[model samples]
Target: MKRLSVSLSAIALIAAIPLLGGTPVLASLQKAGESIVQTLTRPQVKLNLGAEKQVVAQDQSGKEQVSWKSLEGNAVVQPGNILRYTVSSENAGDVPAKNLTVTQPIPQQMAYVLGSATNSNGAKMTYSIDNGKNFVENPTIQVKLANGKVETRPAPAEAYTHVRWRFGKSIDPTTGVKAAYEVKVK
Candidate 1:
């Protein structure tokens, strides 16, 4: 009778696997769903740099006017020319992307234009002067004085190392946000 009781308990425990909703099969199914979601919902970002061009435009006045144009594709830039760098972020997934942030390094041998950074789609912009080690709305640096004292001053345009944009809201699927900043080639 004791052996029969032990056998019945073992059978009952085996039957409880599915009934308790804690079986390995259910766990694997949950993992599969998570994998599908992760694979389906991902953010895609595209970055580009363009040079500004001065174009001559002729209107009905029979006179030519100089206009600024953005040379976007395969642009050729020279020293002392202004270049605009843009970042476009799009959510390719079926769901919204949360906490979307885009960062771009300042091109070497270039100087960032003060207050030229702009953000679309309700984003916040920040600057970093320490090779992306830190970010702030107005980046500054510490200068050590000869008297053994340090003073913080506004960072120069040439000191900018990176720019970042942080989105406050979620980015909807198939929707994109654009951010840009201007820099002068050294």
Candidate 2:
């Protein structure tokens, strides 16, 4: 009877081992599933300006290396003239980029021109009338009428101080991206 009781106890302990071990594994699997769901639902956007390729003198290794590329233009900008800079972005992750927005801070001594934005993807570009603060589709302006009534005025190109590009679909994962525009100096 003593030997039989010992054998029963050993069998019970062995069965308990699997249940105890499975708890951690199950917890880990649940955590992994939650992480995947978060990654899929989270909004992510990646920005990249195109690389510059230039010729450089050969080194002692007899191999030519690409030279430094500047983000700005090589030429100097005169006052009251436009200096264009391109800002590009791509959705490099597995999820799609929703409600895409691009903000370009106006440089000092520069004023934004109205309706000058040219989007590579037509109908995907929008202009912001209120600096870079807010964006809308076909944003309009409000005017006060002489009769104490409010009137709506179509926002002209000049009111457009910022350019925004809204993509209809998410950019492909891990793709080269770029967006550029011209800014005038006051």
**Best by lDDT, which number?**
1
Model-by-model lDDT, in order?
0.82, 0.64
Cand. 1 TM to true fold: 0.71
Question: Tens digits of per-residue lDDT for model 1 on 15-108?
Answer: 9877668768788898999998887766544344445654557989889986667786686777877777667766766778788888888988
Find the number of clashing residue pairs for candidate 1: 0
TM-score of every candidate: 0.71, 0.54
- Candidate 2: stretches off by over 4 Å: 1-25, 33-45, 49-76, 90-99, 131-133, 144-150, 156-161, 174-177
Q: Which ten-residue region of model 1 has the weakest summed lDDT?
A: 45-54
lDDT of 2 by residue, 78-107 (tens): 565555556677666676665565666555
**Candidate 2 TM-score to native:** 0.54
Model 1, residue 85: displacement in angstroms? 1.1
